[model samples]
Target: MEYFSILCILSLSVVTFSETCPKLNVTEPLLFGDKNSNTSYDEDEIISFSCVEERRLVGEQYAVCINGEFYVSQVPDCQEKCVHAECAKRIDGYCNEGGECVCRPGYALFNGSCIDKKSVKTVISLATKWIPDYDHNSSNDFKVLQADICASFDDVFEIFNYTLRCYVSFKKSNQVTIANVINDFTAESIEGPSDVEKAINGAIQLGHTVPGMRYNVTEDTKANSTYLKECDENSDICDDHYGTCNDIGKGNYKCSCIHGTYQSENIKVDGTDCSVAPIKVGLTVGLGIVCGIAVACFIPAYLWFIISPAFGKAEYNTAAAAEVGSTEDEDEDDEEERDHKDDLKRDLEEDEELDKQLIFHQTMIQNMSNFNPMPRVNRDSQSYGVPNSIELSTANSMDNFNHQQSN
Candidate 1:
């Protein structure tokens, strides 16, 4: 029973030890910190994270392993960098993940408060409101329904199935207010509000404004019928903001700044702020300093080795040529000496055997009578009978031969 209980406990321990932690969803890559590959993380094991380029990680950047699970104090959001997209307008704005544009830091929505106070003061002549009088006994006979009222009857009345809604609006000091009414509706000077709405919306999307300009809408007329204020004439807003205004017809203007300039926060400067001035000056100074250093190091060596010799005095040139000629003469003399030595060595080797032969021939010629042209006497026949007193001499033999020749 004790052994069986111990076996059951061991089995339970094996099963518990083998269990792994659940997989955690890490949106950002694990670029730093803990690099353990074992998925079975113990408690308090921290893991760090980072986002891809052009994206910033918001909120907590680390997650801790707790109880076989990743516990994050705060979930991180990898937000896209604002400078990569919609931040080019000089207005503080950013682009979201869904590609929608929103304002960035240090900027709020444009309320009725005008950015160009000077332009508003100089350009705006008057301000008035066209209030709609909803009650009138003569016009009451024909019921006029607003756009909302018409849309409310869409389910009950099938004829109101069209999706478009016409709206009426007024322009005052570069600000716009709009109200929509039903189709086929007509009122005092508000008959062509739909076309005006389209034109105004298009102009606003294009970043143009008809500032301080009044427009009169005629009944049953297109938007072209209304006489809009000239953009160039009402361009005091751009001038006040230190920008250039290009006048598109029909009361539209586009504002812009000069090149190498940008609207920067936290600094007040004239003419778009000239953002690259410091960088340009820094690069120019750095390049000049580098060029000066290079020239200072190289010019002396170049002058010493190449330029001075090329343009030196005639005396110096002659001396140099003499030195070169002397070196060549020495080399030629050494070569001739080597050749002479080689010739002497060859002569000595060829004449060695001839010299020995010449010495032997001279010795034989000097003692001509010493050698005889006769056969040698046989030593074996004389060995048995000749006594030691009989000695043959070459001189005696030569004398005997001479006497015989004379007889």
Candidate 2:
């Protein structure tokens, strides 16, 4: 009984090592890992951390001691890194110093995302067609240039009512285009044909790009026959909104010279006097020419017949030629002289006729000031120039309007 009692006392005193013993940390000693919520250590024992259930440690699964105060190895919290509810709150992403989630280069977020994704690429086309008008703004026309459906940020597209059109025509072109109204660009879109070439060159000149003007998609839309409306005489356009002669303000119209044609299509050529007869000009010119020629021929003929006779009578009657004329040879010489005079008159008539023909050739170039080509001027300029002088009464009225109430 005494021996049995003593054995019981020893047994009771030798209770197994404590449960808290595993909780204490030590190093250079055997390491421990708690996988199934039980902390224990053993050599050759493949173990996993409680945090990383599937991750195995081969040689030293975990340090018996958590080494230095600082954590050099994988933190017990490494598993918690991915447990964040939102990617926005994640620290793994290459965010700014702020804890914002940022996608690395060559990537973009889709929705609540920080990921590596391919860059969204888009192709833009610049070829455009549009209705042209001088008085109404063409940029407002629908279906003008190829609009980039993707250029607008998603947020911006959701916010604005974006309806754009390309109104190109034979008259103008904007060489380059951009989001004009969205930024500080101050180019006015007025009720006039925007010089397309000028606008394109201007955008290129400004060198402002990045959030480029996103244009809409372009598709060939053919004209419908039955739905097509004929131009209205009152409207001044092909479809009557504005173009061609119908759109011209009251007395105005557009004119252009096309390839293979010179200003012939719907061009107006005018001279100062419509009622003044063209025949009158030709008649006056012809009559003047005839009179000038007649006077020219008559003076020469008078000098040859009247003046030469006086000289000849004085020379022959001086007795020198008269004394020799009695011989047969002298008579023959006199006859030859007479024949030469006759031939000279024939040559004069021929010369006069030739002069008339030469003058006629020049008539087409000169003498017809009425039919000259008018110097080209901006058609609008000729119609709009202010008269040099206004009536005294009109000037006074204008001065009063400038000073007093316009009404």
Clash totals, every prediction: 0, 24
Q: CA lDDT of each candidate?
A: 0.32, 0.29
For residues 1-407, write the lDDT of model 1, one tens digit per residue.
Answer: 99897656533311222223444544343233434555455544555556777666543344444334443322333455444233435333434223323322112212211011001001111122333332221121111212112222222122222211121122233322222222211122232434434533343232122211122222122222232222332311232333444544332344444443444442222222223212355655665565555555444544454443344445445655676758776576567556755765565554454455545545544444243223212211211111111111011111232343344
Candidate 2, backbone clash total: 24
Off by over 4 Å in 1: 1-231, 234-236, 239-242, 247-250, 266-282, 305-407
Off by over 4 Å in 2: 1-327, 334-339, 346-366, 374-407
State, as a TM-score between 0 and 1, how close model 2 is to the true structure.
0.22
- Give the Å shift of residue 10 in candidate 2: 82
Residue pairs with colliding backbones in model 1 are none
lDDT of 2 by residue, 193-222 (tens): 222223333333332221233232122211
Q: What is the lDDT of candidate 1?
A: 0.32
Which 10-residue window of candidate 2 scores lowest in summed lDDT?
384-393
